[model samples]
Target: MTGMKDVEVVVAHSGRATLRVGDVFLKVDGDPANADIEVQAIGLAPVPTPTVLWREDPVLAIAAVPGRALGALGEPSTASPAAWAAAGAAIRTLHDAPLPPWPGPDLSDIRSKLDRECEWLLANAVLPADVIRLNRDIADAALRPYAPAFIHGDLQIAHVFVEHDEVVGIIDWSGASRGDAMFDVATVTLGHEEHLDDLLVGYGEGADREVIRAWWSLRSLNISRWLIEHGFDPNVRGCEFDVLRARAQER
Candidate 1:
């Protein structure tokens, strides 16, 4: 805890904030439940995770996991295809582990939420109605029930760490829960669709490409409002807006 000469802000918004100090990360979440889930999920995950150094109300201190994030959204990944495949292997390990005790959003709730989000998008003129409609229809395929698996609810590329073409660890477990495994697959590849084949190779074969695409549409539609509300511009190149537009143009 000494030699805290510099503190770098990792992320900050209304919901939560993260700071990096030397080799430790300090996370402050508005909800204590998130902290609890993170601790438990990391403990259960098969992959390497940041060690929990300490915890105080609303603040959790974790030793840094070695290596850099796999990549960032809206940016081309410089990591090798092997690294992407390694990340997929790590995700497969996590999915194979026993499901967390907590339940995730049921299909009914997901459908309801998607409906509400679509309605909001139209009512507020967030996107062209046709764009919304097309993605909405595509997203419908993801709403069907499936066997749940332990999921890293927010498996963005930036949350995965890689070194020497191997996955060292994954960070940000607050969203971990029992959910559709395809959702995790889709999430990890979001805004970085070019890596999908590499990832799937390591994830194993026979995965439903259609379901993964549906999850992409579902995830983009579900998160757009929150991103905009939190001061992020999804319209940035290769981000959510672009993902939706790309899907719309397909077929």
Candidate 2:
């Protein structure tokens, strides 16, 4: 345990807030179902996860896991290649496990959401039209049919923790569901492209390069608007805006 420390606000938005007090973290969700799913995901995941302390109403308390986050958006990761690989290994284990009973958004739902997001982006002139078009094209590849697997649904790299080149824990599993494996992989490597090979080494088969890249674009496109609405900047260096622009320049 990190021992007693003053309360700190880890994150806060209109919808939810996460606060850290001593060695325990408290997450308060706007939607109670999110907290319920988080509890279920922690219990179900095969890989290391934060230990749940208790749940009451909209709040969930969990003991802080050992180690630090692997990385954060808009920041280059200083974590070792082996640490990335260890996170990949954990992901592979999660995906290879039996599918979760709940299903995530289907291809049609995902496409519809992306289309709506793009339309909003274009209407608001939030991003260059060419860049949006290019990313939309890249995102199409991920819409194809594939056998479903248990996915971390929102496997942001920041959720993974590491110490001494080993993944000690992963947190924030509220989005867990039966879904695409590549999506989980892409989410982790979103802004940190250099670590793709290291992650793929541990994930092994089915790490389709093209599909994974497509998910990167798709994820960036989907989250840009939400991030902005939540008072976060998507244009930060190494973030969603740069991700789309970088891919657009390649074509």
Candidate 3:
């Protein structure tokens, strides 16, 4: 064969699956509108994003960006503190950019989801009722009103890439929307709370610490079941379950 590369499944579930082949990444999304948003968001974001190679109905092809991910969810980051700061700076730039034309989920939607997830966690015995209750209380802080900004709704640590203390790229733009900028920060800093200080160095002022912590709980609650059903484990030592338990200890 002139050229052949082994295909790797980066992630997969019912709604979406991402595959990597050589330097190209193909994402298959159930909803075409999400693909539309990713394309538009990359164009609008001030920070570096994957280069869209092509798109067909349910699949989007993008050129791979350079550098390694900032970190994994359940592990320590090898990326330098300065790299985290650079990511924070990049996020700030994105938040300052003009909002995407598409509308994002509103507060009511989030509130309803929270209520629904809490019920499920209890019904399924996902965790201790007390632990869930404590976290649900902490998660309250994030439900309040905040000025919206362009945000990467799923800015998990692995989504940001860095090399030599500089943020070279951020991937997975399907979740980008108009939302709380702090939510983006908290999402990126989840599991690795120690780097929050360094991240804030570049993020600048007006980022509330309390709200960020609250987001940790809220986000853990929101995604735990989805991760489980998608064949991912959120119960590992430093993952989402730990994030929830850590909050309980603080109370």
Q: What is the per-residue lDDT of model 1 for residues 9-70, given as tens digits with 9 covering 90 to 100?
A: 99999999999998899999989999999999989998889899999989999999888899
Every model's TM-score: 0.97, 0.97, 0.98
Higher-TM-score candidate of 2 and 3: 3
**lDDT tens string, model 2, 100-195?**
777787899999999999998888988999999999999999999988998888999899999998889999999998888999999999999989
Instruction: Rank the candidate models, highest lDDT first.
Output: 3, 2, 1
Tens-digit lDDT track for model 3 on 82-116? 99899989999998888888777788899899889
How high a TM-score does candidate 1 get? 0.97
The CA lDDT at 2 in model 2 is: 56
**Candidate 1 off by > 4 Å:** 1-4
Worst 10 residues of 3 by lDDT: 99-108
As for candidate 2, its clashing pairs are: none
| Residue pairs with backbone atoms closer than 3 Å in model 1 (clashes) | none
Measured by lDDT, the strongest candidate is 3
Clashes of 1: 0
Better of 1 and 3 by lDDT: 3
lDDT values of the candidates? 0.91, 0.92, 0.92
